[model samples]
Structure formats: C-alpha cells, structure tokens
Target: MSKRILILTTIISLVFGLAFSGIIFAADDSYWQDHKEVLDELQSDGKPPTVIPVELIPQEDEATTALRERLNEIIDEYAPRIIEMSDWLYHNPESGYYEYNSSKMLGGELEKQGFEVTYGVEGLDEGYNSVIEERFDAAGLPTAVIAKYKGKTEHPVICFVFEADALRAPTREKGAFHGCQHNMQGPTAVGAAVSFAKLLEEKNIPGSVWAVLTPAEEIPPPDKSAMAKAGVFDGVDIAFFSHGFGPTSKRNEAGLGNCCYLIDAALYDFHGKTAHGSRAWKGADSLDAARLFLTAIDMLREHSEPEFRMMSAITKTGNAPNVVDDYVQIDHWNRNTDPAGQAALQHKAEQIDQIARGVAMAAFNEVDIRHYAYYYNGIEYGWLNALMWEYVHEYGDPEAISEELGKPSGWAECGYPSVNFPGIHVKPAIAGTPEVAGHSDENADLTISEKGHRALVQTAKIEGAMALRLVLDPKLLATVKEEQARWQEYGLEKGLITEDMIRK
Candidate 1:
C-alpha cells in the first residue's frame, strides 16, 4: 500500500473503529463473506454495525437544519407529481436508446420547474454510433436528457444523474418493461433537482444544479461511460445518483469502496468461405472457429481466479446448417470485483483473443475484433457516502430504517465520473416492501405501489438535504473534494485507473 492509502486507512480505523482491510481492493466474493461475519459479530454484541458513530459524522447547524426543513417541504409539495411521473414511466416502458416518451416527460417536468433542457448529447465516438446502428438498429441516443438550473452562481455544479430505460423483454416482440424499477429513478432525481433548484432560488444560494437523464442502465454499450468520455459531465464538481429502494428494515450504509464488477466487453467476428456441408472440407468454416473460441473460453475458467467471470453470446452466425457458416459474431464480457484486478482481466482477455485468432487460423478464417466498452468501479468518498447514508436514514420511513447498517454498496452508475469529481449513489429503504429479485415483473410492480411512492418521496428529501448541505457549507464540500483527491490517487497507485482517464 502507498503511504497515502495507509494514512487514509488509519483515519478510517480511528473514525469507524474497524480495521480497514483493503478498502479499495477487498470486494471479491470473500469480502462479502467477511462482511457477513462483521454483521454477525455486531448483532451478537447488540450494536449497530452499519451506523457510523454520531460524533464522528458532521453535525447540522441551525441554518442547515432550517434549509433542509424547507427543502423537505418543497419535495413534499411535489410528492403527488413525483409519484405520477414514476407511475407514468412504469406504464409506458421503453428499451435502451429508444426512450423517447420517457425522456420527453422527464425533461418536460424539469422545464416546468425552470430548467433549460437539451434533448440529445453530442460527442459519442463514431465507433459506438456504428455499433449501436448495427446492434439495436438505432442511429444515436436520442433520448438522453441534460437539464440545467443555474442559481446565483455556476461554481459547485451539483448534478443528479438518473436513468429511465427499461429492460428489453425476453423477445423483441414482447417489447420493453420496467423489470428493474428504472421508472422510479428518473422521478426520484427530478424531484430532488426541482426541489433543490427551488431551494437555491428561494434562498438565493450561489450554486448550479443539473439533472442528467441517462438511458440504458440494463444494456450496453453503457450510456454513462460513453457520456463521460464525451465530456458530458465536464465542470461538474459533484454528482448524486439513486436506485430503487430495497425491502423494509434494510440498513442503508455508505463507505469508500467500489461496487459491482469492472467489465471489459468486446465483439469478435470470424469470416470464412462457404461450401456445402457434405463438402465442408473444401471451404473454411467460421462456425468451427467460433465454437473453438467458446470452448477455449470455457477452459479458461479453470485457470481463472474466483473473482473473475466471463459471459458470451453468439449474436450472429450463418443460418443454414446444410452449408458451412461464412461468418459468425460472438459478443463477450469479462468481469472482476476489484479494479486492480483489471490488469489480470485484460491479460486473460488477450488470451481469449489469441485463442480466437488461433482457431480462425486453423479454420482458414479471418477475424475482426472490436473492444466496445469498459466499465470501471466507481471511486467512492467515505465522508460523502456516510453523509448521504445519514440523510437517507434521517428522512426515510422510520419502519424502513434498519437499526443496523446494511453492507456497503459495491456498485454505482458514477464509476466513470468518480475519476473526475465526487459523487454518491443514495439508497433509501422503503417500509413494508417485500424483497423481490431485481429485473423481474414483481419488482417492476413495486414501482407504482404505495411503498414505492413513499420511497420516491423520501429519496427526494434525502438527496435534497445532502445537496443542500453541500451548498450551505463550503468547508464540507472542500473536505469532500480533498478526500476524493486522495482516493483518486490511491486508485491510480493500485492500477485501477490510468492517467488518461483522469486527464479526460
């Protein structure tokens, strides 16, 4: 570990009173096992494991308290509209990159609240555009929305990034549906943005607010990563994101760490000559190359570490079995929990690529490879995450709030943006909500329910309070930025991020 990381770990140990074990790199499967043990230990000792000691977290002053009260009132007044927006999205679901009606409604709501709205973003690379056209038969992301509300000043541009795209049904004929409750994300963000902007105007605060309506959380190429590369998040000092609420009594805790697996995705195309199946020896068989490549990937698992994962699909191949396949396209994704593991994952990916080449050579076939997307783990700030968690518990439904904190989130949408500025993914629990598997019809149904409505309202208040505090207290924002700088440096040292990413 670097000196800075050791110092930060020492601070974390002092503040949270827990050993800081691999804060950035300890998120593999075994990490979860250890996390469960900690929870069990806390339960046995009759202490809240997820809660940070109150004295360690920053306290709200009278002015901050008054502002939060007013922010809550603003969001409360907009509660009915917020619920309606969420319900509307639930009823009219659209797939990724095709969220026309969804974006219109969300952007319209922002415009009604005095934000300047833009429909589509520029700067998506041509390679991504070509891929989208080939795969989804779409030209560009026409549904992405960027709405800005300027207060007395533009410094400290606080952004609320949210998604509105639904999952594509099992088949295209069935169309799209909100199996992941993405319908709730847009409204939750809008409610926060509108209320925060209103608060800014009402109190003459000097800051800016942005509501970024990102599409296609369930599909790739990831829209957020593409947008970040295109400079969509430029000049934003901080960002906030939210997801669907979980079951009741679930503690929502925040900490400095990455969530979900870092992903590297690519598509491989093999080209060969066609011939009759009976005379297959007379022609190169692309299908044989693709099959060999997949077999090699399967064999790779035996040598891969427990944290590594690989998924692939044959997206395209010749139709008739009577004839040798002339072309085959395989889409593949490799994943790992630790960002530092990316280098090893890349080495593995190169091995897979070589396997494809070797198979293609054996089959007398040519190959084309396109590395389309890279999703890195978000660099989380401990202070910001803890503060957001505190606000969620403070404004959340009492019955939904767990006496103990839940496991720290290991994934977020702001992975790309985290390198540039500070951000948090706010997770608030809903009361009386039954836990259902994500990306299911049952989970989708919860978005329009009474529990969902309360969650949406509470989340808005929570995010509003968090943003309000940042705007009200400059020192707090500075502290957050300082912490973010240290984490970014640590990420670089760990090889989780590159210098080019920071420059971008």
Candidate 2:
C-alpha cells in the first residue's frame, strides 16, 4: 500500500511538472506559432488574442529588444529637433491652404533621410494645402507630398500621414501656433518614418513605409477634397496618424464615430462698381451684397444642428475700405455631425448662396460663386482605431484620455465623429485639466517634459510595430484586409462623397 501511494504521488508530481513546462514552452516562439491559427480566427471577432504572449521571444530578437529599450531614445534624441521645428512653425504661423515654409521644411527633413520625395502630385487644382498657415514660398499649390522608402514587398505598403498642419500654440503667440500640437505630430511622424526606414535598412523587415506629409486637416475647406480625390490611400494596407491633446491624460480614448465631415469650401465673388471717393452714388455697393450674403448664411445657421459648425473667413476683401469695392470674396466652411446632416447643410448653403446672389444683384451687377473645394466625409478605419485603442491603453494613462473637456478647450467632436463611433468603443471623458496630460496644455508643455517625449516615442514604436506586423504577422495582416474590405464596402453603400461634402 505504501509503495502504491508513493507511485501515485510520483505520477501526480510528474504531471504537474509537465504542465508547467508546457506553459514555459508557450512563452517562446512556439506560443505564437502554435496559436497563429487561433489568433487568425479571433481577428474576425475583433478581440485581443486570448492566448498568452510568447515569453523570452522578445529577448531573443536583439533588434526588437533594443528598439523597445531605446524606442523613446529616438524620440528623445530627436525630440529637441522636433521642438526646433515646432517652435519655428509656431512662431511663424500660417493659415489654411497656404502653408509654404512649414510644408517645405517638414518634407525637406525626409529628403535629408534619403526618402524619395514627391512635392506636387497632379489632380489638385487649388493654390496650396496649408492647413495651418497661409505663408507660401512653396514650389506649387494643392500639394501633398510623400517620402517613399521602397521595400521587399509591394503588398505590405503602410502609409502614414502627418496631419500636423494646424494653427495653434495654446500659450505662445496665439494666432496660429502649434496650439493643436500639429507641429509635434508632423515632425514626430517624420522621425517615426525615418526610424522605420532605418530599421528596414539595418534589419530585415520585409514591408515598405510611405511617410505622407498631408496638408489641410486642421482647417478643411468645404469645396476642396484633395485627400479623398488623390486616391493616394488606394493601395495602402495600413495607415497611421496621430493628434495632440492636453497632458492631463496619458491614454487616447478608444472612441469611434461611424461618420465624419471631410472638407468642403466655397468662395463667392460679389462684383459691383468701384467708384472714386465721394462717388459712392456712382458705384453700386458690393460690400452690401457681401453683407447680404453673410446675412443669408447667418439665417441658414438657425435651421442647422446645434452640433454643427459654420465659419467664414473673408479671404479677399477690397484693396481699400473707402472705395466702393467692386469685389468682395467670402470663404465659408461647414462641419455637420453626420453625412446626411452635412449634405442637408450644404444644400441649405447653396440655397442661401443663391439668395445671396439675388441680393448681390440687387446691390451690385454680378455675383459669382466658385466651388473652391469639395470634401466628402467617409468611414474611419475600425481596425486602425481598434489598434490605436489597444496601443493607447497599453501606453497611456486611462484616466487622462478617458475624460472630456468642458467650457472652451475648443475640441468639437460633432464633425470628427470618430469620438462616438461604434467600431472603436470608447469610455466617457471623466475629467480634464490644463496641466500635464491634457490635450492643449500637455501638447504645449511636451517640449520640456519627459512625459511628452515618451508619448511621441511610444506613438512611433507602435506605428513601427504595426508596420512590422503587417509583413511579419500574416494572420494579423489577413484581419486587416478583412476590416479594410468591410470599411470600403460600407463607404460604398453610403452615397459617394467628394471633398466638398467632406468639409461639412
């Protein structure tokens, strides 16, 4: 009986030891290799892998471990450089559709890194796309440049756009500073792209990375829709972009909005008679026509949604105030909560424009309205947002990003509806601050704080990681294709929209 008991004990101990050994094995390459199929299936479900991550594998990849260790090192090493770029941009602020120096410098940085640059792509029939500035020394207009790094495979083309074109600088000289922290985003994007290329060159990453420096995200015009029209993203397997926030929170809210306004802009020219001083009666008042047009638009606003936004900048006014101005140019933009609402607003704006033309005719001779740009809002990529949420939580403080801003931080989600979209579920914003971690303040302070550089570094690593995964992780890549296909179908089912609709 004692021998039988001892034998049973030995058997139980051996079984327990074997189970532990299996777990250990799972932590190595075997774990990922073995569970690859399971993970592929789970991709459709859109959940994180239930299987445990492989252990010791990270240590095995010396390059990956080095990258993870000094991931922030690059951002830190280059953060000051990013700050220099941002500070320069902040001091020399520019408005939408006219950012010359900013674009040049931002794109030029990539050139220094041996990236094949494309300054002006055809199809954009506009002046230029300076989302944050109107300062122009650029070679061409309506330009969206790309820094290309060709790799082993064309199938895994990952594109990243720095929508850092903005007029911000929350605490600095306020007109058009890096207030939106776009300055940070653009340079950081460049750094990330550069780093990605470096990795491929040094190591053996199979995919390619295209660092796209896009303009006109901050101040999207209602009529101009270059991004949507360019079809630059047609062949992209994965895309990564980033935005700024106050330093109060660390994590980005895993929020999703099914719909969003792209960009639309319209300019109407009211032509009248320009008379000499004291010859007011001789000249019909075009200013009155412009005023009438303005009034008509104001009236239309009352019928629009509370969440909707309407703004106008007098792009071109008369050369002189005393002269009975012969021409008055009005530039207007609209941002609606959803596609239907945006279309409705645009229809209403057109009606108002006609009324304005009639009023201009009453006050002047002729009225001309030109569709400056058309932006059609489209679907946000669920996979991308899901990926972002996964990354944001892993790296960021949940409390920081999960909160909402009150009063006047000026983040209106009505148009950029990704906030409430169902694809990437999000928690409500619980709190906000003007301190570190908040969107505006934190962005402003990132230059001086380690936290800020960390944020930038983390974003870069995740982007690079995703880029790496696109080629290395075949199972993950299939899931991405599934999501992208679904999104494309959904965008199609909804009426096709142009940049004009995108603005509102």
Candidate 3:
C-alpha cells in the first residue's frame, strides 16, 4: 500500500469501528451496487407485511351503555360554551410564560365548576421566562395552573393536561397568535374535565380528577418535563394530554405506534479582550473562536447519522466590524428519534464543549458552555392506545376522521407526562384546511372560523367520553396499568427511559 493510504487506514481503525469507517472510505461507490442487488432480490420474492382490519366494537354492558348516553348529553349541553371559550382565546393570544390571561381563563372555568385551583409550578429556563417578564410587566416565571375535583374518595387520581400558550408568530397582531391551535386545547380540556366531573357527582363516583394547565408547549428547547417531577402529577393514577391536529384534509388517525424525537438545546459563550482593528495583536478575538467552533460542527455533520439533526444560530458578537469582539454566543438545538441514537448524538454534542475550549485556547480566549434543555421522546402503551382507538371509534367514525381534513397527529412533549403517568397523547382536529400550516396566519384564522368551533366541540366529546370511561372502569384501568408496566420494563432495557429519569 502507499504510505498515505496506510496512515489513513491506521487512523480509521484507531478512531472508529470498521463498519462506520468502511462507509467513509468505500460506501460512496459500493452503496449503489449493494442497493441494486437488494432491490432485484426484493422484486423477485419479497411480500409486504399483512394489514389488520379495523373493527368498531361497541361497549355492550348495560351500565357502560348508560354512561355513554350521559356523556353524549353532557357534551351536547356544554360544547357550545367550550367553543365560545376557544374563540375568545384565539382572539386574545399570549406567548409562552406571558400567558397570564389565558391561564386565568382556563383556571377560572374549572374553578366555577367547583375545582380547587393553585398556580405557579416549576421546570423551565430562566431566559424563556425573562421574555414574559419584559412583555407583560410581571415576573414572567414558568407557571402551571392546577385544578382538583375531589370525589367521595380519592382512590384513583386521574389528571388531564392542557397547553394554553400561543406561538410567537412574528409580524402577526400582538406579535403572537394561536397558530399552533393551542387555543383549542385549553377549552377542550376544560370541557372534558367539567363533563367528567359532573358524571362523577351524579353517580357518586369515588375518584378524583385534575386539570393541569401547562404553558409553552409550542416554544421548546426548555421542555416542561420537570414539572411532573415537581409534584403536579402526585397521586395521579393516569394523565391525558390532547392537542389539535396538524393540517391534513383527511381525518386524523388514532395511533400510538408513532415514535417522537428526543430534543435538547445548548449554548456556548466565548470571552476575549477587546482591541482596536489596527492593534489586533494586542487582544484575542472571541468571534474567531466562535467561527472555528461552528466550522468544527460543520465537519462533524458529515459523520453524523442521517436521522440525527443539529441546528444552530450565532446570537451575538462585537458591536463594530473594526473592533475585536470581546464576547460571542452560539445556540444549538439537536434531536434524535431513539434513545441509543440520542445518547450517541448528545455525547458528540457535549464534546463540543471541549472543542469550544480547544478553539478558544488557540484564539487566546475563555469559554463557557451550558446545556439548557433536555426532553425524551414519548413512550407508547399498547393498551392505552387501544383504549384511545376504542373511544375514537365509539364517539365518531375513525374512517371519517381519517378521510376528512385533520392531519394524522403523533406524539409531542406530552411524553414527559405519559412516562411519569401512563396515558394517551390525543390529537383531535379542531380547525384549519389541509393547505393551512401550523404556526401561521391562516391557522390562527381557522381557530375562530365556524368549522373550527364545530370541530372543537367534537374534540371535547371524544376526550370527555374517554376520561369518563377510565374513571368508571376498574378492570380497564388495570389493563392499562399492566400495559404501562410492560412498556416501562421494555423502555428501561432499551435505554428509552431510566429509573432515575421517571418522577417518583
């Protein structure tokens, strides 16, 4: 072998495994050849996986049938008020931590229904809260409003979560709006909780219901996972999180098979000394250090897995082009679909802290790095998902929802609550055409349209019926808990979640 080739081979063997390094050296040419061979073989003999038929099985018990009838009546009576509340929220949008009015409206509605209310829960970044402070003339700290309905006995504590904050839609009215359809979430949750609460009262059901109003779901990087650990889910038997679907002309499908992405955000700050442009040698340049760090990130991307993602923005630098920059900051957000994948990518990102130091050392500067956010992907429980599918089928036609304009909804940050408390992450379509995108002007308009109001009422009925079933059926609850236990064991073995990671 040539001397240069031998050295390159040695380095590859030393630094990376043969499989990964082999791809680096030979896959570009060999991949297509392998791809063609696989394709030819598949064409000759491969068969697709078998598809299962969807059955619309109804709950046939006499008591269950009676319960369903009552739930329908409750939804019909209360949906109009719930729809009005959603319309009000759409017109008056608030962003993230500054959702004071939005929070108040949701909390007040529950309070009127005889729920005890509490405010201000923790687990969000200080910087995010600072925006609310500046804009609202208030402290703008991270907050979650909780409402509790105490039945005869609190044996089973069921919780429902609602996301109330709107998105930061730049150039829109008030610089914020319900582009994400969060306005639908609060009203829907409240409607469902109130309906379920009434049923418990009339039947003297011996269990409790909690309405947890969570904010800032659309604005991430600093996720609200810690809030559950902070006691919001204390004594909770199960928790449910539901949201509006993305834009799809077809009706949204009921699914728990979809895996969400693990996400995190980090910041790096480099410090140096300022100097005149003419006397550049007199001081170090933080901007040079920052640029070098970003270049290293670009190089790392080439070896990264196809599913791993990294996005960054340079936040600040020197004031003038002529002067050496004394300070520089770069924000990085990354995501991965699986636990093992997330671990590897996070390790690689953490290495950038050392890389920042190395680059700053070369540039005669100092560096500081902080990992500001961490969120795990949602866990799926087969029994919980099956239950949601049953409710979706019972309340409305699953085929109709799928064929209509609602997007097929998947998991989001609600996994935090799901992990700590076993539940389904529901996506009910409230408004918007397939052409309307989320976090946009058209989506905001959809929230106030007549179709939007109709859809919101239907969402309430579905979620309310589901919540009431869990409250009334002990056998069903047992089945769900068993499924969750099995899923937890699998997650631990696969590194999807850790014992320490779950809230006690």
The lDDT per prediction is 0.75, 0.52, 0.64
lDDT of 1 by residue, 1-504 (tens): 346644653453333222111122221212123344544454322222334333445578898899889888899999999999999999999988888899999999999989999987787877877787797765557788999998787766889999999998998787889998899999999999999999889898878999998777788887787787788888676788888888854433533234566788889999999999999888899998998998889998999898888999999998899899999999999888764676787787898888888899988999988878777655655556567767766867677766665444433553666766578777786767897998899999988888889889988887888888777655456545545555566556667666666743
* Candidate 1 CA-lDDT value: 0.75
Worst 10 residues of 3 by lDDT: 44-53
Cα lDDT, model 2, residue 9: 30
In order of lDDT, best first, we have 1, 3, 2
**After superposition, which runs of candidate 3 have C-alpha atoms over 4 Å from their true positions?**
1-60, 122-143, 170-174, 245-260, 275-282, 337-340, 397-399, 403-414, 428-435, 498-500
Error of 1 at 170 (Å): 3.4
- lDDT of prediction 2: 0.52
> Best to worst by TM-score, what's the order?
1, 3, 2
lDDT of 3 by residue, 291-324 (tens): 8988987887887787878788888767798898
Using lDDT as the measure, which candidate wins?
A: 1
- Return whichever of 1 and 3 wins on TM-score: 1
The number of residue pairs in model 1 that clash at the backbone is 4
lDDT of 2 by residue, 79-152 (tens): 56765675666556565456667878878888988888886555544443442123343323444677788775
